[model samples]
Target: MLISDLDCNTLKTHLSGQGLRFRTGPFSVSLRATIPAIARHIAKLYPHSETLDNDAFIDFHITTHQVAGLRRWLKPQVVFSFDGYKPFKPLPLAQAAAAFEWGLNWCIASSSHQYLIIHSAVVEKDGQAVILPGSPGSGKSTLCAALIHRGWRLFSDEMALLSAADGMIHSVPRPVSLKNQSIEIIKAFTQEPVWGERIEGTTKGDIEHMCAPDSSVRQPPTAIHAKYLVFPHYQSGCLTEITPLSKGRASMNLIENAFNFNILGHQGFEMVSDLVDSLECYDFTYPDLKQALDGIEQITSAKP
Candidate 1:
């Protein structure tokens, strides 16, 4: 059954009771939280996501609960838990949705070592996937959301799962998180991009999640070979430009941007190097969103 099939009341009951098990690409997530905001966000953002059986093996069992004592009554807060253990301090109760999203990211990055998790945004088209690896202020999420709107399949906005054996990247599509000015930028661009709710005062400033397209959310999990490596840098007034980067440099960047390079050691290096050797690397910089996308479209449309 799809998650949206159940109303808010039913969802809340399931979460508070047996928990809600759902498939999220490579991981089966079971979420439990008493917060109505969590229920509402799931109802809206995860409408197309499959609701799995409780007997299913879960990769992450997460929950959020109100703190005990007088603190619960005065300036109430919520703490996120993983496997019955709270990993983070309490956050303002109003940020429950944000906390839930952040907690899910932590669950993947911290524990899921089956794949080499890279801090990158991945999107695919025409059997070719472009891996966008960047640091803060790199406009990776912005580019990801834009490409999804333009019809590219969303792989992931935060994490790119690279297999250690075959070197293929697995899709972990989820809601694209938008922050600060990028929120308004997307709103003004798309006619009605599916969005959950606007949250303010986040560590990354105002944030909201652009819902994964129903097509992407419902797509069967598949692994695709990486065809291009894009290191995107966004500047206010610069003209869109793409520069070819050497395979050696791209491999180094992938290792540096990887979440668990040290964990995998030599195996990680070999996996990243093999993947880079097969792709054409580039440095992409842009100011105008249209021009930026056009540049990418032009690149992806070519015979690789």
Candidate 2:
């Protein structure tokens, strides 16, 4: 059954002591935390939807506990449990949740969106969606967080859900993950908008996540025509530059970055290739957020 069809009150009560409720596309996620930090992150990423009134297609039950009994009891279709909060050191709770949600969506994509999900960050402004596909530390999440704060609407910060049938960008707005220095960079850049505690000692080092703007959560998903396929790289003190990339190269790179490309095999390649053909592809590198945002604006504005 879709999450929207479930009883909201029962769900809420079940997750009362948990974290916040984040409703997007077809999911209502209830995290296990009291700080409202994660919830706020969800709000920012999906800033245009109302809280599900006990009915939503997507529901997340997250907890930091180690009890197997609770895990078996909850019986969540997707369960994410970390070891000694180590991996979380470089990825804060909100960011980790975003990654977890993206992975979960991939597990259920066949039933949920019928599309092959990819590991990427997506943002939309002026009716066009910019897809940022990269391996971890490519600075995808950091760039996304900066753009959304500067006025772009977040489609997602970890997963890019692409419609197989038409190559249209699908929205799965969720929290954006920020790791180590990126966390502080974002905080300093955005003036440190009320952040939660930083979880330390993880595979990626110390990490924290920034809440998506409430505006992104509440807004309805927009079917954006793909306009740009940007592979963003963040380098300190490097000048911002956008270089055109061939569709074949972008396709290969994207396939490598995909979580389920091989799982879907030829069908996945075709779907992703079609998406690349439908848009312009580029490799972008930047040392500053302002220049990158301006370059993006130019690209979007130049289109009809």
Candidate 3:
């Protein structure tokens, strides 16, 4: 059943008790929380995601509860626990949903070494996937949210799980988090009807989460061979330009942004090398989203 099927009270009851397990591509995450906002957040943001029937070897067991001591009544903070161990300090209770989102990402990036994880977003069209790698404030998430809403299939907004056994991208299409001014920007950009609450006062400033389309998240996970490796940069008043990057440079660049390049060692090297050799690499700069989307279509649709 989808998370949307459960009412707010029912969702809270499950989370406060047995936990709610949901599948996103290769991993299954079971989340529990007592924060009222969490249940509402999940109901809206995770409505497109399916809840697992039972915990048969769950990948991540996570929870959020009121902090202990005087602070529980004073400032009212929430602590996130993973396997009975608190990995992060207590955060303001208002940030419960963001804390949960970040915690799940940490779980995957730190432990899921079976796949060569990278800090990038993956989107596909006509069976061709474009891997986007960028630093913070690089507009990666904003661009990703735009593409998925436009027509492309969302692979992931935060992490790209590249298989070592086979050179294919695994989909982990969770909600795309928008930050700062981008929150209102996206609100004005699309009317797709999948935005969560506009949460404020996080370290990243005001933030919001947008759910992946039901069709994208419900499809069976398929291993994808990447077709484009584009490093996107959003520059105000700058004309859109797609500059080619050499395979040698692209490989090195990918390693710099990879979450577990050294962990995979030789296997990671070979996998990244193969990707560079197989796909077209480019540095894409844009001042406007529509123009950038146009530029992508011009390139991806062209004969390789």
Candidate 1 backbone collisions, by pair: none
Listed in order, each prediction's TM-score against the native is 0.96, 0.73, 0.96
- C-alpha RMSD of each candidate structure in angstroms: 1.3, 6.6, 1.3
Model 1 steric clash total? 0
The sequence of per-residue lDDT tens digits that candidate 3 reaches over residues 1-304 is 8888887778888898999888777888889888888888888888877788874668999988888799888899988888887889988998988988888888898899989998999999889899999789778999998898788999999988888888889998889999998877787889885788888989889999998888778875567899999999999999899999999999998999999898999989999998789989999999977877887888798775
Model 1: per-residue lDDT, tens digit, 43-66? Answer: 888887888986889989898877
lDDT of 2 by residue, 73-126 (tens): 454222343222212222333344443544445434434345667788999876
The TM-score obtained by model 3 is: 0.96
Please rank every candidate by lDDT, starting with the best.
3, 1, 2
Global lDDT of model 2: 0.64
- On the 0 to 100 scale, the lDDT of residue 303 in model 2 is 69
**For model 3, the run of ten residues with the poorest summed lDDT:** 48-57
Query: What is the C-alpha local distance difference test score of each model?
Result: 0.86, 0.64, 0.87
